[model samples]
Target: MKSEPEYTPFELMAVAGARELKDGEIVAVGLGLPVVATFLAKRTHAPHITILFELGVVDPEPIHTGVGLADPRVWYRAKILSSFVDMLGMVLHRGLVDVGFLGGLETDAYGNLNTTLLGDPKGKFRHFVGSGGANDIASSARRTIIIIRHEARKLNEAVSFVTSPGYLRGYGERASAGLQGGPSRVITDKAVFGFDPESKRMRLESIHPGNTVEDVLANLSFQPIVPDAVSTTEPPTAEQVRLIREEIDPERVYAG
Candidate 1:
């Protein structure tokens, strides 16, 4: 009998994130692991997925995960190279986006994100790379997918600031505030969390292999709605691992 292949947490995270995307969906992809996952989906399952960058890059077949969002290498072979206004105002706000793929410094039970600062906003707070169109994407995209590290401090009861609105306090609050889309899932190295449809609280959908429910719970500042039984995340297949190692992110730019 053959045993399962070895895989890194980053590879597992990327494959797990990629599986959430569907073919032909227009996805607003942010920098970091999300870029890797989105491209992996396009290469394997979601070939027709339309990738959108905040800087107005649409359907760009990136040669590699670039040094930064502005790196020229990330814009190679684009279907449409446009402006921020066109992508955010014209496309996103128009309610045409299917999925918003993003990463942040922190996330809360409500799925609210913070890429801004750690300490109290009114006090001495260190700055972080602020929401560069993440706010727009999460606000208008039909659904948003967040990928971030799983740590107690990073998974707070509430984020320092609401850089991107999730359920925004509860179930009807987002709609009350006129925000179109809400967070769909939060994928971490240890687990995958989904929001409760009624209460809008985060719930443990699955735990990554090698991690237990207690392990996942211990990393979160707030308790999530865990079910009686949790599924294990599907690990990356041999082909997917090969693609990630050789094609998608050979340099370990983002997936690592």
Candidate 2:
């Protein structure tokens, strides 16, 4: 146990993020950590995986984060350079995307995300940013995966605002209203969470090493139900972390 590995915050979360992609799956990585995980996967495991960026770049042979789809780096060896609308509406909305990876400013216990307005009615943001294509991706993605560095406030009961929708109330109630593409898996700094099939609420499945249920629950927005017997989240092997932090991002990206 002592000689196993020691992972940094991002590295740990990145590992959890990477596992969300299977051996072969098309993942629509939002950017940043999600991108890091995808790149890591391309290098270490999912050689045949297709990573599509919101900016319309596909299968970019990037060693680090590009500024955006239009960034020269993205176009250098990319397979596609289409438009955002076409990608989301025509491609993504049609369920062509296998996974949609998202990073968030806040995530509710049910995995509801708030990435746009923070907390204000008049314009006060607890944590704000341009939403980009989050809305479409949330509603039409084949499946959604959320990547966030876990903390108490960020994973609170009430987000200052509603950004990307998640298990707001429940499934049937939501489906009847026509809201689609809810959270599939939520990877965080502390643990990996998934929706309970029955309750349809985000439930703790595993704990990260050096972290505990108490640690995670202590900061959650609402009380998260622990599976009768919870277990520790499997951490990345030293090799996986090194591949992402070093081999994959050899250039030390300024913006990923």
Candidate 3:
């Protein structure tokens, strides 16, 4: 029998995130793993997936792994080279984008994200890159997917500050605020979580290979609703692994 291919946690995370996207859907992609995931999706299963960068490149075929959205590599072969205002206001704010991918320093049960600071705003604290267009994309996209590292400190009962709205107070609160959609799924190294339809709280949907419910629970600060029939995340196929290693990110910039 052929043995399973070795893959890193980042590769697993990217593949898992890529699977959430569908063909013919327009996705507002951010930097880091979200960029890698969307590229992998376009190269493989969702060939028709449209990728839009916050800096205003639409359907760009990046020549190589990019440092950020504005990198020249990301601007290669772009279908639309427009201004930031046009992209965010005309495209995103109009609700044309199907999904938005985001990352943050902290997230809560309601999926509220804090990419701002670690402690009280008035006190000395570790500061992170503030929201550029993350807040706008998260609020206006039809659905949003958050990708973050899984750790007890990063997963909180409530983020220190709500940089981007998720379900707000949960359930009807998001709709009440007139937001079209809220966080739909969260992809992590250990597991996959989805929001409970009624409660709007994050729930354990599936665990990644080599991880268990106990492992996931141990890393999370708060108790996430667990379904009885949690499934294992689909492992990356040999072909997918090959594409990621050789074609997608040979330098191991984001795929590592």
Query: Could you say which candidate leads in lDDT?
Result: 1
Better of 1 and 2 by TM-score: 1
> lDDT scores for all predictions?
0.90, 0.75, 0.90
lDDT (tens digit, per residue) of candidate 3 on 14-45? 99989999999999988888887888899888
lDDT of 1 at 93: 89
Residue 116 Cα positional deviation in candidate 2, in Å, after optimal superposition: 1.4
Mark the 10 consecutive residues where model 3 has the least summed lDDT.
Answer: 61-70
- Model 2, stretches more than 4 Å misplaced? 68-70, 122-127, 251-256
- Show model 1 residue runs off by greater than 4 Å: none
Model 2 scores a C-alpha lDDT of: 0.75
Per-residue C-alpha lDDT of model 2 across residues 1-256, encoded as one tens digit per residue: 3688766777777777777787678788776778778877777778888888776778877644567655676556788877787677677887887778887788886677788766675765444575778867777776788988677778877666667777776656547658766788888878888988756788888888888788888767688778779888788898986786676665646212
Q: What is the lDDT of residue 190 in candidate 3?
A: 95
> Which residue window of length 10 is worst by lDDT in model 2?
247-256
TM-score of 2: 0.90
**What is the RMSD, in Å, between candidate 1 and the native fold over all Cα?**
1.0
Q: What TM-score would every model get versus the actual structure?
A: 0.98, 0.90, 0.97
